[model samples]
Target chain A: MTRFMDVHHGMEGITADQLAQAHQADLAIEHEENVHFEAAWADPESGTVYCLSEAPSAEAVQRIHERAGHKPDEVHPVPLQV
Target chain B: MTRFMDVHHGMEGITADQLAQAHQADLAIEHEENVHFEAAWADPESGTVYCLSEAPSAEAVQRIHERAGHKPDEVHPVPLQV
Candidate 1:
C-alpha cells in the first residue's frame, strides 16, 4: 500500500473533538475503499487539517475523504519515510 | 507559488524546542531558495513532524529541509484549501 497525506483548509476555530468526529467518519468507510485512515492533525489557528493514511492510490484517499463529507484540498503521495 | 506539506518520521522523542530550532534553520535559508517555512507541528509521542510551506516546487521544499538537516519522509502538494 502507498502512504498519502491529504490537507484541508479553512477549518479555523475547529476543536479537537470535531476533528476526532471527522476522523471517525473517515474510519467508518475506510475499509470499503481499501483505505486505512491512520491519524490526523489540526491547527485551529491556521484552519488547516492533515490526514495520513495508507491506501491503494491517491484516488482512494480522496474517495474516502469525499465519502466522509470532508473532501481534501489536496492529496500527495508520500515517497520517503524516515 | 504552490503550498506543500511535508512529513518527517522516526522522531518519537523529539522535543518542541528541537522542532523550533529546526524551523529556524529552515527559515534562515528560505529566501535563497524561494521557500517560506510557515508553520510546524510535532507530536512528541509519535515522533512525527509536519511542516507547512509555500515554495516554487516540491524539490525546493526538499532542498530547504536538506539544508536544515532534517530531511522529510515525504512532500506533497496542497491543491485545495477550504
Candidate 2:
C-alpha cells in the first residue's frame, strides 16, 4: 500500500461534527478501497482538512473523496515509518 | 516505518522558498533517522506545511522540526501503502 496525504479547503466555520461527517465519508472510502485512514484532522481557522491514507494509488484515494462529496486541493504520497 | 503529517501555523504569507528551506530541514531529519520524505508541500495563503515522513517515532520527527527552527502544530501517524 502507498500512503497519501490530501488537503482540502473551504471548511472554515465548519463544526467538528460536520468534520466527523466528512470523516465518515473518508471511512467509507477506506472500506471501499480496503485501505486505512491512519490519521485525519481539520483546522477550523484555515479551513483545511488533512487526511493520511494507505491505498494502492493516489487516484484511488481521490476517488474515495469524490464519492464522499469534497474535492482535495492537493494529494501527496508518503513514506511509512516501518 | 510510520508516516506522520504535521501542520504548522504562522506559515501564512510564507514563500515556497522558505517552505523549501523548511523541507531541507526535513531532509536533514530524514537523514538522521534513516527515513524518507515521501512528499511535502506548503500553502502560501494558509502558511501550512504538510510533510509525510517515514520515521521510527513521532518524537523523532518532532526533534527534526525542533532542530530545523520551526515546531509542528500537530503530528499524526499514517499507514503504508505496501
Which one wins on TM-score?
1
RMSD of each: 10.8, 8.9
Tens digit per residue, CA lDDT, model 2, B1-82: 6666666766767665676777777786568766666666565554556777778877888888877898888876544221
For candidate 1, give the DockQ.
0.06
Put down candidate 2 lDDT per residue, A18-79, tens digits, no spaces: 77787777786667776676667665655667877888888888888878888788776644
**For this target, which candidate reaches the highest lDDT against the unseen true structure?**
1
DockQ for all models, in order?
A: 0.06, 0.08
lDDT comparing candidate 2 with the true structure:
0.70
lDDT of each: 0.81, 0.70
**Taking the candidates one at a time, how many backbone clashes does each contain?**
4, 10
Model 1 local distance difference test score: 0.81
Candidate 1 stretches greater than 4 Å from native: B1-82
TM-score of 1: 0.55
